[model samples]
Target chain A: MVTRSFPGRYDSLAQIGEFIRGITDKAGLNNFAAYTVEMAVDEACSNIIEHAYGAEDQGPITCTCKVNTKGLTIILEDRGRPFDPELVSEPDVTGELEDRPSHGLGLFFIRQWMDEVEFEFESGNGNRLTLYKKRTTASTKSTRQK
Target chain B: MEITHTQYKHCDLVKVKGRIDSYTAPQLAETFNKITDDGRFKIALEMSELDFMSSAGLRALINTQKVCKRYNRGELVLVAIPGNIHAALDLAGFIPLFKIFDDVLSAVGNF
Candidate 1:
């Protein structure tokens, strides 16, 4: 597992993206998987910054990326208030544009992009969200051919 | 980050020229929301100058698209999407979600 610490703020999003990109590239993920994983990972991390940390400009957010033959797994642990992904819901897109809200789509996009995701909490500990993306057969084949 | 705006006959062309990360995304969203809230639906966003974008930026654009689509008034077209934004959109399966154009004029012309 590779771990990198980031400031719990929006600017740290770039650093988070770079970290995920490095891990995915080493995992032999192609541009497509790389992009998807990065997007999903960024969304999850953004949720932590915005919701977990309440967009506070203080504290540190840590991301641990583990890669193996199966695929890539990223565990995002933040030292903020515990958050329940269950209570998090997708935004309703069917409503009128004027009446619509700009939030709630981050997790929805994560669910759509990532192969699997789970959320957990450790009492006084901060929230930990795990996101996993398996290497597609096509990607594996391409890697083998290379 | 740099932003340039060009007004067409029926719409506005906003070119975002930088990384739309978590911090800048809200600014972009706010700019877009101001436009949409004022009932300007026929809009084309020129992203050729954009270098990077986080999921927050993607959410902002998607949120704008949803707003435009909801009014049933006009369309939100992405014009000259740079390679990085294209890659991001492709990964998120958003290429088919918005009408794409090669140039801002072409995107605006469609409206």
Candidate 2:
């Protein structure tokens, strides 16, 4: 288990990606799987920085990553306004190009890429976004490839 | 992200290098805005060197495409997309939205 906290700003996104990449590499994840995990986490953190804290409020987003035999779990916590993910209406992905909505793709990508995701708000914990990705045989095999 | 554009006969070929995330997505948006503002709607993005892209980047592409189409000008095409970035676009259900080509020449030829 490894935990790090970063300023709730867009510049910290690369630092967060680097941290997750290091852990996924050590966990024997393939390049594709590792990249997916890194991307999913990046989207989640961006949401927190933009939606939760807004542009005026700059807070700290603490990320905790745990790797085990089965898979990896990442928990992101931020002290900002909490909102319901359910209220975000799904965009019509198949709609015509002119009709498609431009926004709301961030949370959509997070849910699609990660194997599991959960969001919660607690009195002292602020907003906690948890994401999990399981290790697959294909991922392990790809990791062994040159 | 670094964005460089080359003007062709029918369309402009924009090459992007580096990661496009929340911070740098604005740079991409600015490039698209500049192209569309000039009434050049037929655009092809060469993304072989784009290492990473977040949803913000996706939004920039979508919004730029929308502006182009709404004005009855043209569309935005993609060229030489990396696998990981392609997967991101695929997962977002954006694979079918734009015309994707294997090379800049082919993409420009489509315009």
Report, for every candidate in turn, its global Cα lDDT versus the true structure: 0.76, 0.86
Expressed as tens digits, the lDDT of each residue in B9-104 for candidate 1 is: 699888898677677788888888888888788889888777677667777877888878874788788988766467556555567668889886
Instruction: Give a tens-digit lDDT track for model 2, residues B27-105.
Output: 8899889888898899999998988888889999999888877757799998888888887787677888888998988
Q: Would you list the clashing residue pairs of candidate 1? A: none
* Candidate with best lDDT: 2
Interface RMSD of 2: 4.5
Candidate 1 TM-score on chain B: 0.93
Which stretches of model 2 miss by more than 4 angstroms?
A137-146
Residue-level lDDT tens digits of model 1 in A1-146: 89888888877787787788899999988876677678777778777877888866757888889998988999888878888878876666555445445566678767876778889888777888888888874274321110
**Model 2 residue A35 CA deviation in Å:** 1.6
lDDT of 2 by residue, A1-146 (tens): 99999999998898898899999988878888888889889988988988888862479999999999988999999998885899898877887887878888888887876889999988766799999988884274332110
TM-score of every model?
0.78, 0.93
Which segments of candidate 1 are over 4 A away from where they belong?
A93-101, A137-146, B33-41, B49-55, B62-75, B81-98
